[model samples]
Target: MYYIAHRLFAAHDRALAAQLAHHLALKVGEHQVFLPFCDTDEEDLVADIKGRRLFELDRERLRSIRALIAILHGPSPDDGVCMEIGYAAALGAPVILLTTDFQDYSSAPAGPRTVFPDPLLDALATRIVRVPRLGAPAQQPGTSRFANFAARNHAQVQNATEACVEAALQLPLPLPTISVPIRDGSTVYAEPSSYTAPNYALPGRTTIAGVTVLGPTRFEAAEPIPAARHDWAAALSSTRIVVDGSGPETPPGAALLIGAACATGRPVAAYLPRSTYTHATGREPNHRNLMVQYGLEATLRSADEVTAWISG
Candidate 1:
């Protein structure tokens, strides 16, 4: 049986610790939770109260424990739970550090911060290689205190779920627009508004130094290349930046483009739309070709929007 030693006892209040342990116990079957009582243990005659000083638990005995769930409460030297968590981490035991605050911790590298019972249980199930199970605790609805607690925890879980779903959705639809480079003294014709076409004219005599210049814009005559570039960069500065995979370095020179947009005061919105690019294309060349063309069209339309925003 897998054990989840309650390294949270020292950090949480007695009531809160008891609540957490009860909830955790419900999630994981046949688990052990250690609660150290220095004064009480000394006064009482409980031989099972294991600790280095209390029951003289050594490294070998501690190694026998399976996992450690560290609860990061406020700074307190009496927090024996934190120390136990550190020891467990040093022993290479699976450690899940729980914290409500975002304060910096020099002792242990931060892990996921979770509050909802479902998420906390899910984390444990993932680490301990246990079967997944999520169920709300049974309670009488007439009680105000229980209802209030459930309402708060339910909202927290819902918010976490929404955030996860949003992140998953953002992975495929990156950028959603691209700027068309228009330089000084360049004749630009706007493209007719179509389902998959940009509003800006294609590249004529101007180019934005390093980036690829897409053709066929249906917008106003082009301005100076540097000025257009700066304007486009300015618009992207505040947009959120999303990357598909940081493992494989971003496409060559792509980093520079993103970096330039981010260097400005605004947040650059960038995502690896390539993931969904292939999805947009089907087995037939007609649809695949159309998708590719539409991507270019969207890029042009984006440029028009940015230019308009910049000019505005």
Candidate 2:
């Protein structure tokens, strides 16, 4: 079965997602495609403990999906979608990225700076399919828009969905083997921009709490970050907490860190602005993505807090 991974927050986004799923079903036959928002219980997503139930539900659903039809839109694609893509790629499932929105609001790569979709995300997907800009078809006038106007017309949407379906049909799944690049671990893994700026620093131990961090290759200075770069997969194994000080005001890059971290059983700790998100858990990280909001262990408020987290 094919899975449609998308954002379901905004009214237009919801409409667009529903529109995509509808179009996809027309081409591939009914009851074959699964859209998360359409299939899952949203009420249960909230009532469950910290949304762990939804997390588990989605993980299991992706495990069985044949291909991932990921909708890439907005300044950045949905973080949940990114996590979905990462999981699908790990399972060796084909990921067909379909986008009607083509604009890069993000910056060039510098430190953890994210681009249109972070290079890391670009690396994971099997292939990308770009559709013509979406807008109401010429015959249709003033389509009711709840949030933002629909960018692509009906015909373009049809074409994009068709292309995605064809691509999914052609790609091979469950490849015999997949290659993943690995980087040696470091005790502390912070962006090059972060180290010089003084967000958090280890007190003295190259090894924290007996975990040979990121693994064995210890870095305590500005120079190491550049060498290590942002290979989150390789780094997460060795690093305890990835300290990202870039809050929403700056639009964090490559969010793959969160995806890769979760995929590999690592905890990502970041300093977030209070303006982002606040929850019943007073110490929860200020994040927009429910996955990040709940999966995150804590928000680092000070160097002492960082040290305390790393040590424990």
Candidate 3:
């Protein structure tokens, strides 16, 4: 069985949802599910159906399908799909809706009695014969080198300024205090106080070449400061090492900088936001979930927070 979620939201969120749908489609395809997005036009829909048949899930080739699972995260009205799920139920095809929000649709009468908790599992278990588990697990191929590399670098590939600082500090080399020179004046690593006169150094701070002022930090016109700062981090790499700004969140450009550095086999670190890294070693999963999921432990496995947590 195939299911599609109608994506109706802002551009960025919609794009992310599409990616999520693609991942879901791949999972469903493994079980021979034939889900085509309803939002697609006639041309795309037809092409999708044919593509699924030739490459992965062949709806026409499969004799029977269990059910179509529609994932719903919100309580917005799905007036368009009320009739469709109803039709599926009438045809003896199971219609399941998964929603995080509580919504009562009994009066609306959409489809076959809506199941709770896990509609997809419920439909498959009750409405259709479950696909039997294989006796022996299939041998999966080893992880590719590029994938392993990315996995190790993702935490340090943070798309936020805070992450850039965190990643830099974790580097084996001592991080330089960054400074940015503005058109009218100069700013120290995107920090205002760094530009102050007299010694041009903050109290208890001294500027050292290649160890301070690590930046040509630029900011979006409307934004207050550069999202991230980068220094020529070459000493560690025998080339110009780009230091990402640690004050603000990382901008899109900063992520590319980090990615390029990692690609060259050079050590890359991002200054993760304190909020993001505070729970890196907590017993419960924190913001590091995605980082860990992507195999980015090397980038995130710093001793600073772990030591602090232990001492505290």
TM-score of 1: 0.29
Could you say which candidate leads in lDDT?
A: 2
Tens-digit lDDT string for candidate 1 (1-312): 122233323333444435444555454442444433322242343343222134233223344555554443333311234234333433344554443432332211343332321121222211322112222453656778767676655554444333322332233222223232323222221212212232233325233322323322111213222332343333233232211111122221122223232222222222222322212111222211121121121221254453432232
- Candidate 3: C-alpha RMSD to true structure equals 25.2
lDDT by residue for model 3 (1-312), tens: 444323233453344335434554554454443433323322233442332232122223122434434433333323223223322332334444433333322212443332222121222211221111222322336977666555533322222212222222233322223222211111122111111121122223322332332333222212112122122121222222222222222322233233333323333343332424312121233332221112111232333432222122
Selected candidate, larger TM-score, 2 vs 3: 2
Scored by lDDT, model 1 comes in at: 0.31
> Candidate 2: deviation at residue 276, Å?
3.1
Candidate 1 residue runs with Cα over 4 Å from true position:
1-12, 31-43, 46-61, 75-79, 102-312
How many clashes show up per model? 19, 11, 31
Ten contiguous residues with the weakest lDDT in model 1: 286-295
| Candidate 1 residue 33 C-alpha distance from true site, Å | 4.3
- TM per candidate comes to 0.29, 0.68, 0.24
What's the true lDDT of residue 269 in model 2?
71
Shift in Å, residue 305, candidate 2: 2.4
> Which ranges in model 3 have alpha carbons more than 4 Å from their true place?
7-20, 26-65, 73-75, 102-312
